[model samples]
Target: MIKVEEAIAIIEANSTKMPVELISVHKALGYVLAEKVFSPINMPPFRQSAMDGYAFIHSIKHQYDVVGISQAGDHSNIKLKPNEAIRIFTGAFVPDAADTVVMQEHVMANKDSILIATMPPKLSNVRPKGEQIGKDEVVFEAGTLITPAAIGFLASLGITEIEVYKKPKVAVLVTGNELVKPGKNLKKGKIFESNSVMLEAALQTIGIKKTKVYRVKDNLKATKQALKSILKKFDIVLISGGISVGDYDFVKEALLQNNVKELFYKINQKPGKPMFFGSKNETLVFALPGNPASSLTNFYIYVSPAVKNKMGFSEIHKPKVVRKLNAAITNNTGKTLFLKARYDETNVTVLNGQSSAMLNTFAIANSLLIVPQDVEEYKKNQLVTLLPID
Candidate 1:
C-alpha cells in the first residue's frame, strides 16, 4: 500500500496527451484546443456605429443636413461633407469622414436635416477599427477549453474548424454475480447494481462520450476472457469490483494474465483502499473498489484527472480551497479519509454516512473534506482543505 499522494504522482507521470484532430467549431464545446487559434480578420472589420443615431463630423454646430441612412450589415458609399450627418443604426458601418455618432434619442429629426438637442462629444458612440480584436491576434491559446462563449467568439471570427485532442474510448466492466440490474426482482442476497450507472454518468459529465458498460459474472476464467477481449478494444477500461483478496476477487489475476503492468493495487486512503491502477501499452485501466461510494470517490480523485490530462487540459485537478469546518469529526484509521460534505464559500459541513458503501450522504455533497493521515480529530471552526465537485 502507498500514500494517496504517491499514487496520484504515479498516475500523473503516465498520463499522456492524446492525438489531435480537426473538428468543427460547433462540435468543439468543452474540448481543449490542441493549437492556438488566431483571428482571421479584424473584429468589427471597420469603424461601426454603436447605436441608432446620426453619424457626423464633430463640430461646433448643433445641426446638420441628413445625407443618407445606413443599417446593420450594409456598407455605405456616401461620404459625409461638412455639416452633414448619416442616419446610422447599431452595428452599421460608419460612413467616410464621419468621426462622431449622436444617438437618435438625443436629436430632433427634420425632413432633410436633424437638430442635435445637445452637443455630443467627439467620437462618441463610435467603435474604432479593430476595437475588439486585431487581425492575426491569438484569441485562444493552446490547451484552452472551448466553452459556449468561446464558440460564439470563434464563430464571429470565422473559425469553421479547430484542432482539439480526441477523447479516449472507454469501456466499463462491472463484475459480480451478486449484482442485479435495477428494476428487477431481488434474489436472496443480491443487490441492484448502481456503480455502473454512477460511473457512466460521471464520465458523461466530463465530455467523455465514448463509453460502454458490460457485466461479467464472478468466475476467474470468464473474467479473464472478458478482460483479454476488452484490453484489445478500448484505450481505457474501468472495472468495478473483484479487486480485494476475496475468493471470488479475480480482477488482479485477470489483469496480470493479460499483460497489464500493475502500477499500484492499493492506496492508503479510507473508502478506496482496494483501488487498482495499471496499464498495458497505450491502454489504461482503473479497477475501482466494489463499493458504490468508493468507486465514485476514486473516479473523482484519480480517473477524472487522468482523462482530462489526456484531453490536453492545462488544469486537470479539481478546485481546492481552504474552508472552515462547521462541525467536529474524527478518523480512526492510519490512512487519509475523504468525507463527503456540503459547503458554501466560507465553510463546509461534513454530512452523515461516511461509510464506504453508503451513497445517501454523497448525493447531497458538493465537496470532499480532506482528513490527512496522522490526524485523529478535527475541532469545529478549524480550517481544512476541500475539493469541490462540479
Candidate 2:
C-alpha cells in the first residue's frame, strides 16, 4: 500500500504526452494548444466605431454637416474636414481626420447638419486599430486549453486554425456476470450495470470524445480475451469491478498473464483501495473498484488527470475550495477516505449513508471531503479540503 501522493506521482511519471496535430479552430475546443497562437492581423484591423454615432474631429466643437454615411464593411473611403462628420454605425471604419465619435443620442440631427449637445472627448467611443490585439502578438501560449473564449479570441485575431494535441482513444471495460443492462427486469441477485455509462459521461465532460466500451463476464477466459482484443485499439483501457479479491475477480490475474506490467495496486485509500494500474505494450490500463461512488471518485482523482496530461494539459487537477464541515465525520485509524458531501457558499455537509455501492448520495454531492488516513474524527466547523466535481 502506498500513500495517495506517491500513487499520483507514479501515474504522472508513467503518462506519455500525445503528439501535436494541426486542427481547424472550429474543432479545437477542449484540446491543449501545442504552439503559441500569434495574430495574423490586428483585431478590428482598422480604426472602427464602438457605437452608432457621428464620427468627426473633436476640435470642431459645436456643429457639423454629415458628409456621408458609413455602415459596417464599407469599402469606400471618405475624408473628413473641420466641422464635418460621418454618420457611422457600430463596427464601421472611422474615416480619415475623424478622431472622435459622438453618439447618436448626443447629437441633434437634421437632414444633413447635426448639432452637438455636449463636447465629446478626443478618440472617445472609437476603437483604434490593434487596440484589442496587435498583429504578430502572441495571443495564447503553448499548453493552453482551447475553450469557447479562446476560440473567439483566435477568431478575433483572424486565426481559423490552430495546432493542438490530439484526443486520446480510451477503452472502458465493465466486468461482472450478475450485472444486467438498464431497462431489463432485474433477476434475483442481479443488479443494473452502470459503471461504463457513468464513466463514459465523465470522460466526455473532460474532453475525451472517442471511447469504446466492452462488457466481459466473470470467467477468466472471457476477461482475458476481451482485454487482449481491445489492448491494441486504445491508448488507455479502464476496467471496472474485477480487481478485487473475490473468487470471480480475475482482472488482475488476466493482466499479469497477458504481459501487462503492474505499476501499482492497492492504494492506501478507502472506497478504492482495490484499484489497479498497469501497462500492456504501450496501452495503459486502470482497474477501478466496482462500487459506483468509488469508481467515480478514482476516475476524477486519478484517471481524468492522466488523460488530460496525455492530451498535453499541464494543469489537470479539478479546482478545489476550502469549506467548513457541517457534520462531524469519523473514519478508521488508517486508509485515507474521500466522503461525498454537498457544499454551497456557506457550509459543506457530508451526506448520510456513504456505502461504496450507493450512488444516490453521490448524486447530490458537488465536492468530496478529504480525510487523511491517520485522522480519527472531525468536529463541526473544521476546515477541510473539498475537491469539486467540475
Q: Tell me, by lDDT, which candidate is best.
A: 1
Error of 2 at 33 (Å): 0.8
- What lDDT does the true structure give each of the candidates? 0.92, 0.89
**Model 2 misplaced stretches (Cα beyond 4 Å):** none
Estimate the Cα RMSD of every predicted model relative to the unseen true structure.
Answer: 1.3, 1.3
- lDDT by residue (260-358, candidate 2, tens digit) is 999999889877889999887668889999999899999988999899889998787877889988988888648899988889887899888688889
Worst 10 residues of 1 by lDDT: 203-212
Candidate no. 2 TM-score: 0.97
